[model samples]
Target: MFIRFLKENRYVSLLLTFLRLYLGWQWLHAGWGKISDGTFDASGFLNGAVKNMSGEHPSVQPWWGYFLKEVALPYVDLFNVLVPWGEFFVGLGLILGVFTSFSILMGLTMNFAYMFSGTTSTNPQMVLIGIFILIAGVNAGKIGLDHWFIPFFRRMLFKNTEKEFPQNI
Candidate 1:
């Protein structure tokens, strides 16, 4: 019942619009800050996460730490580029409601990655809001660009369906 309300309610969609804007701004700010400074580095952060895996409680899991030390660290340059741009684009998408679901998923992915790296910060809060936005789905973007994009894309996708697929089949 609650899920249906979240997914279908018009009032809820308005509320979701607010949430999307907030999350979008948060992400955009963070990414823009990093991009503007031009000094954002993942090595120090990655090393810190790896170190956290050593303690008794282990804030970061061993597997995650290994991946960080091996995969992420070695490709820090790629991350250096990907992180800011990815965040920026995700934020832009959410803000514009261009691809709300994809934006939320990307945001959630980053949130979880941060949490796994032992940084609590606002990732949890963002994740919670993101999950709500995700659940709301198309309704979350109905007040934004998805209002037109969805229908447009739908027409484009199915416009030639009848001709493409044989009726006999």
Candidate 2:
């Protein structure tokens, strides 16, 4: 019942728009700060995550730390570019309601990555909001560009008979 309401209700979509805007702004600010500073480095964070695996509490799991140490740290240079730009693009996609599902999923992936690295901060809250947005599905972006863009693409991609596709597509 709750999921149905979230997926179909117009009022819920309004609420989701506000949530999307807030979450999108948060991501945009973080990314823009890193990009503008131009001194962003993931090596420090990756090393810290690996170090966190040794403490008594062991905030980061051993497997995750190993991955960070071996896979991530070795490609720190690529992360230097990917992280900031990925965040920026995810934020833009969410705000514009372009590829809304993909944006939320990518943002969640980043949130989980940060949490796995032992940094909590506001990631939990962001992840909760992102979950709500994802649950809302197409309705979450109905008021934005997805309203027009989705239908256009559907029409273009499914060009066939005179049959009309459902608006939910």
What TM-score, computed on C-alpha atoms, does each candidate reach?
0.94, 0.93
Predicted candidate 1 versus true structure: per-residue lDDT over 86-118, tens digit per residue: 889889999999889999999999999999999
Candidate 1 residue spans exceeding 4 A from truth: 162-169
Residues 11-92, candidate 2, lDDT per residue (tens digit)?
9999999999898888888899999999999998999999999877899999999999989999999999999998998898
* Location of the lowest summed lDDT over 10 successive residues in candidate 2: 160-169
CA lDDT of every candidate: 0.90, 0.91
lDDT of 2 at 151: 81
**Which candidate has the highest lDDT of all?**
2
Report the poorest 10 consecutive residues by lDDT, candidate 1: 160-169
